[model samples]
Target: MMKSASTASRSSAVHMAVAFIAMGGWAAFANSAHPMPGPLIAGVVQGTLSALITLFLKRMIEALSARYPGSVGTWLPPLVAVLSSLALLSSVHWLAGTPEIVRTMAVPLSVTAVYATVYNLALRRVAAGGVG
Candidate 1:
């Protein structure tokens, strides 16, 4: 049984929403000192980043679905993990007034994009060999 286009889209949407909410919740809980807006923005940022990463995975999944249907669910969460980890690692800007907390939230985001682009272009050269 193959998933229709709409089903795949809805499934992806749900996954994206869950990823966004989870990251926002975690950021909010971990850093209560910062304002809610930053965490909300961070969540949005994470969702956006993860969505981009998903595009890459879609290709691999399409090719593999015929061979290993069960692995789809198991293999997909790591992309979410990558997104959450990237979001947590990249927060550099302070909330509007909070100066004591210094982190490069945006830097990680920019770096993630650069790395993502590089990944898309040169995945065969680096990611193919496994963790560096």
Candidate 2:
């Protein structure tokens, strides 16, 4: 069975995802009176959600590290964090924007890559307690 801490970690991820979805939905609805979502509204939703991916990952890492301790807790937590955040940031495509697509993608991708690398490096040195 998974430890209480791991369960909590999973729960936290779920909570983050739910919160983002809700936020996006509300923002989209508020932006447009009609049932259909607008391009700008959709962009806002994607941006907001993508922005929080790293935040959620960071929270999850802290929670897991504190509870699990050591390497398993350390590297593993960060590994999960980096991977999930990368996955999230990858899916944030704009509805209609060809002119600035390359430029827009570059900044976020570069930032996320750097963040993941640092997170991974730190996690690797975290002690490796007992949990595997």
Candidate 3:
């Protein structure tokens, strides 16, 4: 159980890292093509913030599960994380002068949604003594 939990956490972190890098790279490329300011820096900032958010979300989920220990604990944290992360990312991009804030967030938000869903399912399976 413990090992699976550790593995899941590590897996989630790695997934988030890769997603962040990919999304950042794409953002940078898009910004450059549009002749926008600070493409590289913007990408780096987005990626770093994404990774940090993922770390926080993972810890929050674990802590919630530890305290509540049921479906409520399992699902709520990821739900909250996804919503909050989206809001934060959108806010960051908007503040950075990224045009079409909603459009800018589309890919990253999709990636995060997928991650949250998978991570939650994996945790639930592991908790139920199934293969992670």
Best by lDDT: 3
Each candidate structure's TM-score, on Cα atoms with residue i matched to residue i, is 0.35, 0.39, 0.70
Clashing pairs in 3: none
Query: Which residue pairs show backbone clashes in model 2?
Result: 70-129, 71-128
What is the TM-score of candidate 2? 0.39
> Candidate 2: lDDT of 125?
54
What lDDT, from 0 to 1, does candidate 2 have? Answer: 0.52
Clash totals for all candidate models: 8, 2, 0
Off by over 4 Å in 3: 1-20, 30-33
The model with the greater TM-score, 2 or 3, is 3
Model 1 regions lying over 4 Å from their true place: 1-10, 55-132
Model 2 CA lDDT for position 43: 43
lDDT of 3 by residue, 8-95 (tens): 7678668678767977776676566555566775677677777777667667666655566677866776687778888898778877
Q: Say which candidate scores most in TM-score.
A: 3
Kindly list the per-residue Cα lDDT of model 2 for residues 6-68, writing each as its tens digit: 787667556556545654454444445433445355546545765476455565665666666
Judged by lDDT against the true structure, how good is candidate 1? 0.46
lDDT of 1 by residue, 1-132 (tens): 257756766686775565456544544444455576655555555455455544444455334333433444344433443465454444422333322222423433444445444444343333346553
